[model samples]
Target: MSTASRIAIVTGGSRGIGRAVASRLAAAGQDVAVVYASNDKEADAAVGEIEAAGARGIALQADVADEAAVTAAFDTVERRLGPVDVVINAAGVMALQPTRELDLAELDRQLRTNVRGTFVMAKEAARRIRPGGAIVAFSTSITRLRFPTFGAYAATKGAVEALVPILAKELGGRDVTVNAVAPGPTATELFFDGKTQQDIDRIAAMNPMNRLGTPQDIAEVVAFLAGPGRWVNGQVVFANGGAA
Candidate 1:
């Protein structure tokens, strides 16, 4: 493929895997619109990195699930950076609780951010992503492992997994490949947020790699799907190191 620069929208690009993907794409010579829901500072820093990598960087804020906001954010990116050639839907949240005792609010929050947000971004991507463009979404290995407290969280990811293949078919004629990257336990701040060190270690050990995945590991896979992975449509490429 040509090495000409492309434009991309990377949702939740302020930190973690999102940041890594945005930076990687930029390093690969793609102008990146780093979308962040709330953290402008981190978003600005991410954009700076993208620019420093010799690609344009623009920081736009929007809730991935909010229709009007998402539309406007995409519009701004298109206006400033040209039509988006790739979209990485990395904006998501996770909550842990048993099904019976799960907090209704937390469950709704997860559904809104993960399921609805993914659909909203993906539908828009289907509409605007250029031919040969790619759309990458996030799922979770928890969906495979079926751990006790992750039922709700996994359910949302499972929803995305279901959405990907159909969307890939929807975009088949247009050459826009759609896929998801389901990662196993990662060492992001999100993973260790409330866990004890022992808890984190135990979870890391579950992976056959004998260590947790890193944001960069996930980003590398996302980059493949975004650029060179033209033939890999409608697939969920798991990056868990055999944890699941």
Candidate 2:
């Protein structure tokens, strides 16, 4: 089917990489549903931008970890837009601390949002996504870097990565593709939080490109997978500028 007839739901679409992905899909002529957890205004603004791009857009609020909320969000998309053709699980949190010093509550929160939330969305998508649809889950290059204080966060993403191939296999003859995108150090608020200028520069210098990845850069990869990159499935594509 043409992109103009497709529908996409992007979790965490209010800001950051998720917003970029939603915008890119809209630009590609797909209807987009921008799913946010708490920010109504930002979600509305995102929908405005999508509409400005000349595509149908709607903002739905749902915590990614909440299965009922996610199901309702999908139902809204199907009713207003169409049956979902793409689902991008981009809503997540990062709490960086040494594993030895990390609070169990923090660990639980990360797992809930990153792992359980991804599973919930993936499960829903598996059931509802149209044939020839695609599911993109987010991971992190930190899983490869094995960086300190990233233990818990990486663990959650690692679980997401593990789900990709297995889910693709389960989908079997459905012709739906499941994959993960592991971004390296990116210039997003989530990556910049609690980091010093020195730390930022150091990370930016780690890649051969000598710069952090942009949300658009990562979004382009997603757009490819969602549209024409069907043969590439059940794999983790690192959009990290050779940082890993």
Candidate 3:
């Protein structure tokens, strides 16, 4: 299929890495559906940006973990924009808490949004995305960093990493590609929240690039996977400036 007519769904597309990915895909000539859990204004703004990029765009709202909601979102995308050619599972939550003092409720919340959310979206994409499509899921480099307060967050992402290869195998006969993009320390709200500037600087220095990754950096990788990088399948691409 040609890029101009292709369709893509980006979960959590209202802000951060998801928004960047959605915009990048649209600019690459794909009609885009910008999905968000809340914040209709942000979602709408993202769609506007997509349209301004000369591609069709729409905004849909659904909690990533809600299977029914996500299914409906995909249905809406098909009805309005055509069959999905790419699905980016970028909806997730992150909280830093030491394992010993981790709150059970927090853990459950993270699992529901990160782990279960990826599963639900991937399942839906597997069913609906056309052949030659791609499914890009988000993961974190923290899984390898073994950061002190990142145990819970890293665990959820590890589950996501585990799912990528298995899902690729499950879709063996299909031309679709399944992969995960594991970004190291991107300068997104999720990464900035509850972090001191000192902490951020220290982490930035750890990367050979001596800077935190921008949303655009990660978006470029997603654009590649969603469009021309068909040869790359069933693997995790780390966009972390060689931090790992």
lDDT of 1 at 156: 95
**lDDT (Cα, tens digit) per residue for candidate 2, span 82-118:** 8999999999999899988999999999999999999
Clashing pairs in model 3, backbone N/Cα/C closer than 3 A: none
**Residue-wise C-alpha lDDT for candidate 3, range 1-244, written one tens digit per residue:** 3566899999989999999999999899999999898898999999999999999999998998999999899989989989899999999998888899999999999999999999999999999989999999999999888889899999999999999999999999899999999999999998999989999999999889999999999999999999999899999998999996
Clashes of 3: 0
* Model 2 lDDT on a 0 to 1 scale: 0.93
Ten-residue region with minimum lDDT total, candidate 2: 1-10
Candidate 2: segments with Cα more than 4 A from true spot: none
Question: Each candidate's TM vs. the true structure?
Answer: 0.98, 0.98, 0.98
lDDT of 3 at 70: 92
TM-score (C-alpha, index-matched) for candidate 1: 0.98
lDDT of 1 by residue, 86-105 (tens): 99999999888889999999
Q: For each candidate, C-alpha RMSD in Å? A: 0.9, 0.9, 0.9
lDDT of 1 at 118: 97
- Judge candidate 3 against the unseen true structure and give its global Cα lDDT, from 0 to 1: 0.93
